[model samples]
Target: MDERIEISMLLDFYGSMLTDKQRDIMYLYYNEDFSLAEISEHTNTSRQAIFDIVKRCNKILIEYEDKLKLLEKFMKLTKTKELILNKLNEIDSSCDNIKISNSINEIINEINNI
Candidate 1:
């Protein structure tokens, strides 16, 4: 996975563990695409302080992911769901009965919602 995307995912999974200031800074840097200088200006802090906070928050997020593996499990579950949906689609295409096709379609919708 891309580092930015992985960090974004980590932010989603473990952001609550961070201090409010840390979370807000990460959100601005990663999600809002703020530069360190921009964040420093917005927060009225030194750019070096913003940089240090971002660096520390990144370490914290990575540490949480390393220990918890929520992102890994989430990726596995997503892949499994996609595979199930693909198989269901194949089965649906092969079916001739209208009722069975409708039932399979309903199942596909439910799986998509997952």
Candidate 2:
């Protein structure tokens, strides 16, 4: 998996466990792609403080994921969602061919009903 995606899942899985301040700093740095200096300026903190906070947040998030496997579960869920989306796209593309056949439409309607 991509490192960014892994980190993103880790952040999502473990963010709620962090203090609001930590969460805010992490989101600013990771999710919003803010530089440490930028975050410091925005939050009215020193760069070193932002750096320490982000590092601490990373450690906490990592520990949480390691203990709980929440990130793993989230990653699996993401993969499943992508698979379903791809399958749906394939079905959509095939619909053009299947449109001429009533049976396929019936099957599609049945699947949709389910």
Candidate 3:
């Protein structure tokens, strides 16, 4: 995965563990695409301080992912769900089972929402 994307996913998985300031800084820097100077100005801190906080938050998010593997499992399950849906599509087309296909699609949608 791309570095930015990976960090974004890590933030999603582990952001709640961070302090409010840490989470807000990360959300601005990563999710909102704010520059360090921008975050510093917005938060009334030095640019260097913003930079340090962002760096620490990034490390903490990675550490959480490394230990818990929640994001890893989530990615694997999402991929598996996609594959299952593809196979189900193939089978449904061949077998002409509308009711079964609709039921499977509903289940897949529920899983995706999770």
TM-score for all models, in order of appearance = 0.93, 0.66, 0.88
Q: Residue by residue across 75-107, what tens digits does model 1's lDDT show?
A: 999999999999999999999999999999999
For candidate 1, the 10 contiguous residues with the lowest summed lDDT are 57-66
lDDT of 3: 0.88
Per-residue alpha-carbon lDDT of model 2 for 1-114, expressed as tens digits? Answer: 776666666888777888898888888888888999999999999999999998877777778878999767865766776666566666766766655455545555654553
Deviation from truth (RMSD, Å), model 1: 1.1
Candidate 2 deviant stretches above 4 angstroms:
80-114
What lDDT, from 0 to 1, does candidate 1 have?
0.94
Best by lDDT: 1
Model 3 root-mean-square deviation: 1.7
How far is 55's C-alpha from truth in model 1 (Å)?
0.8
Of models 1 and 2, which has the larger lDDT? 1
Local distance difference test, each candidate: 0.94, 0.77, 0.88
